[model samples]
Target: MLLVKKKGQGVKYGYQFLRMRYIIMADILFEDIFGVKDIDFGGKKFLRVSRIFCESESFKMELLLDVNTQIYPMELGDKFRLKICTTLREDGKPDTGEFNQHDAGPSRADQFEYVMYGQVYRIEGDESSATDTASTLSAYVSFGGLLMRLKGDANNLHGFKVDSNVYLLMKKLAF
Candidate 1:
């Protein structure tokens, strides 16, 4: 299912109109963590390690989380629930389909906010990439069912792999 909401729309209509294109529900464990220090990107502060690579040994698969959130709390050996929600686009409208105004409801804050609960499955430094003091090269992680991908700097995720469980909050700012 996919949710396409225009600016200033909400759930007054119903859930049938607001569906998630992708939602990953699973339990995860943190295996490793890495960080690169202060730098500027697009006028914003960022760290070295910016991506979370996850794998499921039993499933024989891996997923990557590119997060943009700053200052996260997660750590090795920690466990938690993971929820991932993705819409077709930041706006409620489809690129090729006709949009129905009736299907759109009031524009509420909840419509723009995304929240997920999960644990740190695993975190490992990326060995393929060289680590520099200015930044991290790469890292790896794993969980049972869910994962999230964001984009930001490594410092933004500093001290993230320290907590047992974490709540991931995101908001779509595009129109």
Candidate 2:
């Protein structure tokens, strides 16, 4: 609910009587605004894990890849490529009249799934970043030009380390 107070709308003020009004609304989740996707509208990007830092339970992964203003995979470093595709927009929306679902590329079934394979460059866990207690644990994985942050329990992220091969599986919630 939202409440607005007028200049004279107070209990001390008499008639014209003061009135208090409220506007009610439902809560919204963050995922609704940014839907998950694998290959975004921008052209494909190949990246290498450059650095990884863990602060308490939260971990940050850095990658060496191209950066595009149309889409942001992660916090781009000195390395970066931009391939503009007329069919799709930065937000993953088709460019209306110019977009053709069937063109030249992988089929929808093949590209619909979200899976990324990469070698972990480095990893720091609770022991290195925590002093007292740990809260939420997170893992950041990058695929080409895409970046994904996963939050959950730390036990599930076992075996991730420097030069270790890792597979990140994600679900496409929206087109």
Candidate 3:
């Protein structure tokens, strides 16, 4: 969700309308983590990883994986694909501390955090094609074009696009 901050507004009434952009892709990768050695907030500990390559954009991201779970096989040359729904922080700030305090508790300080809800689609081997790699991976699939066709709106304002392919993928993941 994209949050627009109102000018001349006090902290009580600081933020205005939220514009949400939703992209339905198969999977996302936790490229790198850097800055802020350890993150402990919202009852979860996050290890900040830097130099994340999200599709075409390289961003500094934090992966909130299980603290006990070690990031395996994510080496310098390892390649994998993931499906994820990514969004900018809601307070128009990269740092979570910039937002107003919530009754829930302390907010995270990371600019953005992704909730990994999907599974690993493919693991790249030495023979994998770098150019058409995303398309070749089942997890990196995109539902944008299919969403436009099914809804006939040509714009994906809602969260997801439903189609036969989506159903098929969902079914496959279910089992």
lDDT of each: 0.35, 0.32, 0.25
* Candidate 3, 1-175: lDDT as tens digits: 3344457763432123222122112211122222222323343333432222222123322222222124221222222322233322333233332335463343221322222222232222223445543222122222321111111111221333222122111100111
Candidate 1: give its CA RMSD in angstroms.
16.7
Model 1 agreement with the true structure over 49-144: per-residue lDDT tens digits: 334443333322233554434544333322223323221224433223334667654422244243544555544444433455433322222222
TM-score, candidate number 1: 0.30
TM-score of each: 0.30, 0.29, 0.17
Minimum summed lDDT over a 10-residue window in model 2 is located at: 21-30
* lDDT order of candidates, top first: 1, 2, 3
Candidates 1 and 3, the one with greater lDDT = 1
Candidate 3, position 78, lDDT: 24
- Clashes counted in candidate 1 amount to 41
Candidate 3, RMSD to the unseen true structure: 18.0
Model 2 C-alpha lDDT per residue in residues 97-148, reported as the tens digit of each score: 4436575344222432333444444344445546645543444444554444
Q: Which structure is stronger by TM-score: 2 or 3?
A: 2
Q: For this target, which candidate reaches the highest lDDT against the unseen true structure?
A: 1
